[model samples]
Target chain A: MSNGVDNNRRHFLTVATSVVGGIGVAAMAAPFLASLRPSARARLAGAPVEVDVSKMDEGERITLSWRGRPIHVVRRGEDAIERLGEIRDRLRDPDSDSSDQPEYAKNEYRSLKPEYLVMVAVCTHLGCSPSFHPDPADPAMGSDWPGGYFCACHGSRFDLAGRVYRGVPAPTNMDIPPHRFVDDNTLIVGEDAEVA
Target chain B: MQNKSNQGGGTVGDWINDRLPYRQFVEDQLTGYYAPKNFNFWYFFGSLALLVLVIQIVTGIFLTMSYKPSADGAFASVEYIMRDVEWGWLIRYMHSTGASMFFLVVYLHMFRGLMYGSYKKPRELLWIFGMLIYVVLMAEAFFGYLLPWGQMSYWGAQVIISLFSVLPGIGEPLAIWIRGDYLISDVTLNRFFALHVVALPLVLIGLIFFHLVALRQTGSNNPDGIEIKENKGPDGKPVDGIPFHPYYTVKDIVGVGVFLALFFAIVFFAPTFLDLFLKPANFIPADPLQTPEYVPPVWYFTPFYAILAAIPDQVGGVIAMGLAILVLFAMPWIDRHPVKSIRYRSFLYKALLMSFAFGFIVLGYLGLKPATTLYNELALRFTEFYFMFFIISWVYSEPRSRNYYYGAFAIVVALIAVIDLVRDMAGISWIALLVMIAVTAFFLLLPAHTRLNESKPVPERLTS
Candidate 1:
C-alpha cells in the first residue's frame, strides 16, 4: 500500500469496528436486561393458591392473595345471580368476550361455577381493587344499581358477574384468574382446571 | 477585584489555577456573568429550587442510612427512623417538605418563564433542559414515594404503572418490566429504591448543570424581555446588566433566609401540611389485597390526574395525561408571538394565560375529590380549557388571527354545552350550560367591542 491515506479501507474499517462494538455492547446489555425480569423466587411465589369457601354465606366475599394480586371469591345469592342477567345489556362486556379468562370460565358467570365468583379483584383500568356492593339497590350506588363491584379510584362499576359497565374508565370486565373448584367448596387459583 | 488579586497571587492558588480553570469558571459563571438588573420577586424561585434540591439530596443520603428498601421491611424501617433514630424525624420531615417545596418553587419558576417568555428563540435548548429536569424530578419523586411502602404508595404505584398497559401490544410487557414482577412487589421496591436514591438524582443533577450552562450561554431573560446585550457600554458589558455574584448572590441569600424560615416553620410545625404532603392513607402499611377507599396522587400530580379522570375512556385518559406533561416541553414552539413578555402581549393572551392558570388550579382541586359526576363534568370543562390555552396561544399570537381565536373559543364552549346536555339533563346541568354560554359570550363580545387585540410597543431597555 502507498504511504498516502487509503480512504475506502479506512472507512470500511471504521464501519466494521462500529458494527462490532455495537453488537458487543448489545450482547453485554442482554444479561443486565434479563436480570430485570421476574426472578425464580418471584415466579415460585406466584404458585397456585388454594382458598376454602365452605363457610362463606350468600352475599359474603373474601379476598385472597395470589401472585401479589387480590383475588375475590364472592358467594353469590340467587337474587344477585338473577340481577346479573338483568344488567347484561348495560355491561360493556357481559358475555366476557374481549376479556381475560380460561375457556371453561368464559360463559355468562365468568367463573367455573356460577354460584362462587372467583376472579381477580383488580380493576382493569388502573388496578385498584373494586369494592363489592352486592345489594341490588345499594342506595349509595344509586337507583339503577344492580349488585356488583364499584371502584372508588375512578368510579368504574361492574355487574354481579364482574362485568364492566358501559361509560366507565375500566375498558374490560374484571379479570378472571385461571381458577377451578377442587371440591365442593375449595377453589384453586393461578392453575387451570385441566392441571387438576 | 481585591479578593481575586489576593487569592490569585498565592502559590497554591496559582498551582491549582494552572491545573484547572477554577478562577476562570467562577468569573465566567458568577462574578463576570452579566444578568438582567430588573429581576423581580418571581426571580427568586430558580435559586430556591437549587436550594431545595440540595436539601433533598443531603437529607436523602442521611435517611437511606437507616431506611430499608424491601417490601417487607421498608414500612417498618421508616417508622424506626421516625421513632428510634436520633433527629431522624426532623431529617425526614425536611426531605418530605423539601420535595413539595421543590415543586412549589419549580412551578413558580416555570410561571415566571411563561410570563417573561424565557423559552423563546436562543433559550429553547435551555428551556428543554429545564423541562427534562422537571421530568426527572417527577420520576425521582415517584420512586421515592414508593419507599414508604404505604397503602397509598402501593395503590398509587399500581395505578401509575398500569397507565403504561393501556397501549396495545407492548403495554402489559412494559409494565411488567417496570415492576420487575407481575405486581408491585419486593423486586419493584428494590429497583425503585435504586432509581430514586441513585439513578434519578444523578440524572437530575446532570440535567440541572446543563440547564444552568444553557442559561449562561444566552444570559437570563428578565421581566421586560429586552436583550441587554444589544446595548453594551465602553467596557463591552451590557448597560442594563449587573454582575450576578455581588448583585444576585446577595439578593438570593436574603431570599434563602426568608425561604428557610418558612420551610423550617413547616418542617417543625406542620410537616404533613394537613395530609397534603404526607397523605393519611400513607400512614398505614401497604396491603396487597386491599386498596384504600380513595387513591388520589399527591397534590403536585393531581392537576394531570384530574385531566385523566375527565376522559371517560381508559386509553384516552392515559394518553391525555401523558400529553398534558409532554405538551409543556413544546411551549418553546407553541406560542409563536414575537412579544417576549406578557407586558407587551395583547389583552387576549393575558386573559388566556390567567384562564389557563385558574383552570389548572380548578383541575387540581377536582382531582383531590372523588370522581363524582359533578366533579368529573367540571374537570372535563377545565381540561378542555387547559389544552385550549396552548392552541389559543398559537392561534392568537398575531393580531390577524383574532377571528380564529373567537371561532375556536366558541366551538369549544358549544362542545362543552352539548357534552353537559348529553351527560345530564338535570336543572343544575342546564344552569351550568347557561352560565358557560353567558361567560363565553361576554368574553367574546367584549373583545369584539374593544381593542383587546392591540399590543403595546416593546421598550428598548429593561425597566425596573
Candidate 2:
C-alpha cells in the first residue's frame, strides 16, 4: 500500500478533484441562470409608454397601453370628484392609507390632481380590467352607485378615487402608477414629479 | 447466456457490469437500500408521487403531440383531442386526474414527514429538496392549466398574475413581462406552454433526483420516530431495517394498486364532474373582452387563494399567501422537540396539528366560493388558525401526559362531528361532506400517543 501511494498525495488529489468538480458544476449552471432574465423584446416592450390626455372629455376615461398593461386616464368631472367624498365611509381604504400609490398621490383622491385620476386599468382584485362606470345612476350600477370603476368578473367595485369599496373582493384601491404632468394636458404615465 | 464463466455471468447484467458498475448501482439504490420495517400506510405516498410523476410525463408527451398551444387553436384543440383523436380523451383525463393525485400523494407524503418529524437533523437537505419539488410541482400545475385556454384558466391566470402586480412600482410591468402581452393571449399561452413543457419539468426532475440522493444518504424515518441507525447489528446494518427490495417493494405494489384504482375511478367515472375537480366555466374558450361571471382556480390552489382573499390589503394578502407555502420549509427549525413523532408530542401540539389541517380544508372551500361577507369572514378566521399551528408547534414542543392528548382528541372529534351534522342539515355541497369524512378519518387514524396503546412498536431487532 505504501509503495502504491502515500496519505498526503491522496489527500491533495481528493482536494484538487473536489475543487475542479465544484467549478465544473457551477459553470454548467451559468447558462440556466442567464436564461431566466427577460428577453430583449420583453425589455424593449417594458419601456415607459406615453399617452395624450389633452382632449379627454370630462367624466370620460381613456385606456392606453403602458408596458403592455392598460393605463386608465380618467378626467373626473365635478360630480365624480364630489361623489368621491360621499363614498368615503363605504370605501375599504377611504384615506388611501393602505393603498398602493405614489407618495404625492396618497390622498383621498389617489392622484396628482383632483380632476385627473391616473391609475392602472387592472383590477386590484384579480387583474381583470375594470369598466369605467362614471355615472352614479348608470342602470347597471343602480341608484347610489356613486360613479367609479366596476369589475364585473368578481363584482369588485371601486369609487372614482380608485379606492376599493368596503364589501368588494378587491382588497385595496386600484394601483396608482407614478405619473407626472409634463404640462396641464400633457400627461406622462410611469414618471413622477414634485407636487408643490 | 453463458453463466458458467467465473469472470462474468455472460449476460446483459454482466455485459453492462464490464463497462460500468451497473449491478453495484442497482444494489445501492434498490436491493441493498435499507428501509425501516415499521413503515405504514402514510409511507406509501413517496413512491406513489414518483409513479404519478411518471404518469404525468408520459401523458404530457403524448398530449403535446396533438394539443395546440396557440390561443385560437388551444381551446378547440382540447375539444379535438376529446372528440376527434383516438384515445386522446383517455390520455387527457389521465394527465388531468394524475395532476390532482400527484398533489394528494405529495400532501400526504409531506404530512407523514411532519407527523414523524422526518425533517429533523441530518435530513434537513432532504426536506428542503422536497419543499422545492412541491413548489415546482405547483408551478408545473399552474403553467399546465393555462394550456387549456378555457375561461377559468384565462381569468385564473389573470388574477394570479395580478397578484404580482400588487408590488408597488414594477409590479404591473413585471406581470405584463411575465404574460408577454396585455392579457392572457397567444403570447402568454405560448410562453406558459414553453415553461410547462420544458423549463419547470426539468427543474422538477432535477430536484427529485437530488431529493432521492439526499434521502438515500439519510435512510428513512420510521413510525416509532426513533433512529434505527443508533442500534446496529453485528453486520453494521440497522437492527430494525429491512432490505428495501423485496420487503418495501412488495408493500409499495399494494399502494400502487390502491392509488391506481381511485385514480382511474376519477378519470373514467367522474372525468367532467365540475364540483369534484374540473370547473364548469373552463369549457368556454378564453375571451379577453369578456370576463367570466364567476372565476375560481382549481381546488388545489384554493387554500392560498382563500388566504389571499381574506386579507383586506393587496400586498398583505400576497405576502400571506407567499408565507403560507414558504413557512413549511422552516418546520425543521420551528419544531425543536427531542422526539420525532407526534406520538410523543404534547396534547397542545397534536391539537394544533388537527386545527391546522381542518382550517386548511375550510380555507380551501372558502377560496372556491365567491368572496361573500360570510365567506370572507370565515376565511379570515381560518387563516389565523392555520398560521397559529406553526407558531404553537414551535413554541410548545415539550412533552405532556397522554391523558391530555386523549381529552384534546375527543373534543376535536366531537367538534368535527357537530360541524358535519350542522353543515349536512344546512344543505352544504358534497365537498363539505368530503371534508367531514377526511377530518373524521384524520382523527380516527392518529397513531397512539402513549406507549401502552401503541399498536406497532419499533422492531427490537432486524430479522432475516
Candidate 3:
C-alpha cells in the first residue's frame, strides 16, 4: 500500500508536468503572441481588453487572456442552448452544485447571458488546465464524457454547466469567476460585485 | 570541491582535489565520446547546423544594431544595408540564406537522428532539446522574416496569425489583440523584430547548448548502428571509435569550411541570388486590402508550410503543422523496429523514409502557394502521406535482413533522386519529381507481409 502511494505520487507529478507543458505553450505564447507587448503599466492599470465580438459568429469561441490566463468565452450552439434548458440527472450538482458565485450567477447555465457561458477555463481538479471538451460523445474522451471540461488530470469530467461529474476526481465544478459585460463585446472581470 | 586539489606545495589530498573529480572517471571512459568509422558525410550535418547557428548569431548581432524595430525604418534599414553598408549585402544574405542552410542541416540532423536511435533512453533529452532548437530556429526565422515586413512576410504572417481565429471562444478578440489592432501592422512589426532579433536568439542559444551537452554525453550513434556503451575493447576504449577532439574536428572543419565558402558566396554575390532569396517586393509595407501574388514562405519552410496551407480548416491546418514537428520527438519510442540502421530494416522502413522524403519535398513545394484547388488537393494528399509515412515507417520497420536486397534497391533509388536533384539544378532538365516519385514507389511496393525464408544468409552484404 505504501508502494502504491509512492507510485501515485510519481503519477501525479508526471500528470502535473504534462499539464504545465501544455499550458506552458499557451503561457509562453502570451508574450510573443501579439507583436506588441501588452504594455505592463497599462495592463496593470486593470482595464479590461475590449473585444469586437460583432464579427464573431455563433457557436465559435474567441479566446482572450485576462491577466495572463486564457479566458475561453464560447458562444453556445443551438443544441447547447437547448441542453441548458433541460438539466439532466447526470450533473453531480443537481442545481449548479457549488454556490461559489454571487446571487446573480446562481442560475442553470451560470452566466450573465444565456447564450454565452463564461467560466475560468482552468479545471477544478488538480488544477490541470481543462480543455473545453465540447463534443460530448468524442470517442477520444468517451461515451459518458459529457460535453464539458475534460481535465487530462485523473480523467476528471465536468458538464457544460461547469458542474463536476459524479465519481470524478474533481471535487467540485469549475470556478465561474465574477464577470459582467460592459457592452456586448466588452467584459469586465474582478468588478461588478453582483457578477463578481 | 574538485578545484581545490592542487599538488604544487600542497598536500596530497589538496593536489588530488584540484583536478575534476571525473578526470580519472572521464579518462576511464576515454571521455566516453567517440565517432564511429562508418559515419559518412551525412553525419557531418549536425555540426554544420551548429556552424550555421554561430554564423546566424554573429551576423544577427550586427544586423540588430542597425535594424530598427519600427515599420517605417525597418524596410528602409534593410535597403540601407543592401545599398550602403560595407558588406551589408553579405550580412543580409548570410542571415537569409543561413536560415535555409540551418533547415538543411536540421532536416539532415533529424534524419540522422531517425536513422540512428539517437532519441533512445538517457539520450532522449538530447533529441528533445534538439527538437526545441528546431522549434526555436523556426520561431526565430518567422520573427526575423517579419523584420523586413515584406509583402509575403506581412500577408504570410497575417494568414498564420489568423489561424488562432478557430479557437472556440475569445478567438476573435485574441486574434485582434495578437495583431495589436485590426491587422498585422507597424506595432506588430516592431515587437516581432525585437523577439525575432533578440528574444528568440537567446532561446536558440540556450537550447543548442543543452542539445550539444546531451549529444556529447551520449556520443554519436554511428552508421554501424552499434551502441559503444555495450562493449568496451581491451584498451578500455570504444573499439570502432575516434576522439571527437582532433580527429573528427579536423575532418568536420573541411565540411564546415566548404559550407562557409558557399556561405560567403550566397552572402556576397547573390544575396537574393536564387529567387528563393525572395527580393524586396516582400519588403514593401503591408497593405491589408491587397494580398501578394503567390504568397509563399522561404523555400526551406515550404514542405510543412505546404502542409499547413493545404489544410481546409484554419485551426486544423495550424494543429497539423504543429503536430508534424512535435511528432518527430516520438520517433525513438514509436519506432518499434529491433534494428537501428536502415541498411538492415525490412523492405517497409526503407520505403517509408523515401516516401517521407518525397512527401516532404511535395508538401514544401505546395506550402509556398496561393492554394489553388489542384495544389490544395495535392498538398492535402501529400500531408496525409507525410504523417502516415512517419507513423508507418516508425512502427513497421523491423530489420528482416533477408530483405537486404530490397534495402539496397531503395537506397539506390534515393541516390538516384539525389542525382536527379543535382542534374536538374545543374540545368540538365532532369525530372527530379519523377525520380522522387519513383523513390516513393519503392516504399509502396514493399512486401512487408511476406514471410522471409530463414535459409537466407543475411550476412555482411547489407553493410556498405
Best candidate, lDDT:
1
Candidate 1 TM-score, C-alpha based:
0.94
Whole-model lDDT per candidate: 0.87, 0.78, 0.65
Interface RMSD of each: 2.7, 6.9, 18.0
Query: What is each model's TM-score for chain A?
Result: 0.92, 0.81, 0.66
Candidate 1 per-residue lDDT, tens place, A1-196, comes to 5689898999999999999999999999999999998888877787899988999999998888888789899999888777777777778888888999889888888878889898899999999998888987689998988788999999999987788988778999988899877899788898889733
How far residue B237's Cα lies from its native spot in candidate 1, in Å, is: 0.4
Tens digits of per-residue lDDT, candidate 1, B378-440, equal 887788778767766776566554575478668868777666544422233565566666656
lDDT of 2 by residue, A98-195 (tens): 77889999987788889898888778677887778888789878687988888865567888878887656687788899899887778888788787
- Model 2 iRMSD vs. native: 6.9
Q: Arrange candidates by DockQ, highest first: which order?
A: 1, 2, 3
Q: What is the interface RMSD of candidate 1, in Å?
A: 2.7
In order, the TM-score of chain B in each prediction is 0.93, 0.85, 0.80
Report the lDDT tens digits of candidate 2 across residue range B294-328. Answer: 67778888899888877655576789899999999
Clashing pairs in 1: none
